[model samples]
Target: MENKQKKIVLTGGGSAGHVTPNLALVPELLQHGIDVHYIGTDDGIEKTLVHDIPFHAISAGKMRRYASVKNITDIFKIFKGTKESKRILKGLKPDLVFAKGGFVSVPVVWAASKLKIPVILHESDYTPGLANRLCIKKAQKICLSFDTADARSERSILTGSPIRKDILDGDRAAGLASLSFSGDKPVLLIMGGSLGAQAINDAVDAALDTLTQRYDIVHLRGKGKLNPGLEGSDSYRQYEYMEDGLPDVFAAADIALSRSGANAIFEFLALKLPALLVPLPLSASRGDQILNAGYFEKRGYAHVLEQENLNALALVQALDALWEQKDEMVSVMGNSKEADGTSNVLNVIFENIGVQ
Candidate 1:
């Protein structure tokens, strides 16, 4: 709308599970000559992921689903976060605010709404979180990761989730080198969401000797401590994160063991990698994982194992079942629908922002 590059603000964090997807949109917006600013809390994962980006820090206090005395303190924190967000908006005067909903995004979205700035939100979960639900009315558009989440909002459109462009374009040879493994054996990729699944990690820890016997393993340790329990064993590698290069890891893998987060789930499908899913328990407040895992299970694209029922034995058994039916699994993976979500999403944002 002006000669200067349009300033845009993005807010979301509190966990890598949310932040990583938000980060994926940065380069795209930058390529379009837009200046991006972030608003997030100091207390959450935003600090680690968006640390390099220009950001306004806010005190978005903790919000617990269950009743707690701490709620009183957090309410005050949320209000403080809103004030900080208002100041940032007033100073930046962004053309739009793109929010990936979480505790951190609440303030920025609220401020943008009050200031009458166009706001767009993305929900990576099938069941939207409370912060996102609150922003629904004020949000000019809602980008969703799955079809199931559509019922919650009239403005919702399925955009999958933004992932690194290279990941969406990976080749097999690049995939093999990415994990530092030879192309001889079938590669297996394991990820326990963003923070790492300690329970899944423990189960993998217990079955390492058994698993490496058949598959080359690339275990993403998430935020969990890395002990290198499988170092002495051949064909096993572990890391606390995968920011450096991950398309290679996914491209090399014949199968993957992953927690059911929207980013991971859709990326796996985009890569057409068969998977065994472990949904974070219902008590986790985001019942979306269950819905996500179930949707794939219904389509035979992946398998789901609830946390309570997951153990080393069960995990191995599921692995074996998948291996035994490799042909069927591959066929299912091959049939997966192609997802060209980012371009579609950008169109929606452009139309609303009055971009030519």
Candidate 2:
């Protein structure tokens, strides 16, 4: 008799970063004939981001750093989410659970552990997030993006972050044409991330005149952050967010100014895009981006401009410095052994599932 088709469930959500790596793995998984499904909250960004697969929605309690009234109620929600996960997993009977850390992944990973199903967790930061930290003991293996001291355990594998194939297939001409750019000057891609960076947006507002003198700018100002005053500028274009043309934008960019999220920086490395990183301040985040930027900066893969020193003048000066070192940064990126981890992650998944 023929064996049943191998099945897998990917779990992650809360932000675009959490869902992106899982998306990168989908094409390859389908090509290999592995059945793929997704588990996330019913209303998360993940639900809208994921398509063409059996997506099972489950309750997920958000992870928080501070005590709040929601924390008390979320305990019950988490318990309910675990129950929902167990029911879904039993029905799917997946051979493995592959997860990129996010709040939604915690309940699912916990449920998978309880079911005696093997789980593989991918940590896309210099330091593990709380979700991954809680699931570490339950996970069979932990995949890492950085070769940090804390991730030196036997079960940890430094396979790097998986990058979407389309992100690496950007066409400069297409990007320029789509934006109505003349390509007379280098393109500057400024991304403040999905929710938008007010500081970045404000800095650009102050520096636009100076910046546009030498570079055409593409600004992904996050949702609801677009400035109508700057809409008429010929050398500048702004979008709330992009999907269809994002690869082209990346392709056309001469230098990237972005938040140093693990997913972002790794993709930049893969494309050999020179970057000027502005990590989220520690007061606003867990300091993961700071460490992530530090790692790349130390290796000459990118330059870091701290959020504390961020201003219109500082932004311009730092970008000028990044432009000066751009060629060297590209050379360093080309020589670096770190790369997209799609194949490595797939190999690990197959190895654990007792398949090729």
**TM-score of every candidate relative to the true structure:** 0.88, 0.96
**Span of ten consecutive residues with least summed lDDT in model 1:** 335-344
Looking at candidate 2, the ten consecutive residues that score lowest on lDDT are: 335-344
- Residues 1-356 of candidate 1: C-alpha lDDT, one tens digit per residue: 65766878888987776687777777877888778898887767787678546977888876787899998898998888888899989999999999987888888888899999999998887778888887888898898877663734577777777765778666778767766678788888999876788888988888877888888898888775687545765588889988766876777788889889888887877777788999888787457888888987887778888889888889899988866766686687576542555665676677776666
Q: What is the C-alpha lDDT of each candidate?
A: 0.80, 0.91
lDDT against true structure, model 2: 0.91
Model 1 CA RMSD to the hidden true structure, in angstroms? 2.8
Which predicted model would earn the best TM-score? Answer: 2
The residue pairs in collision within model 2 are none
Off by over 4 Å in 1: 1-4, 51-53, 149-153, 169-171, 174-180, 222-229, 324-338
Candidate 1: Cα lDDT at 224: 54
Q: Give the distance in Å from residue 208's predicted Cα in candidate 1 to where it truly belongs.
A: 3.4
**Model 2 segments more than 4 A misplaced:** none
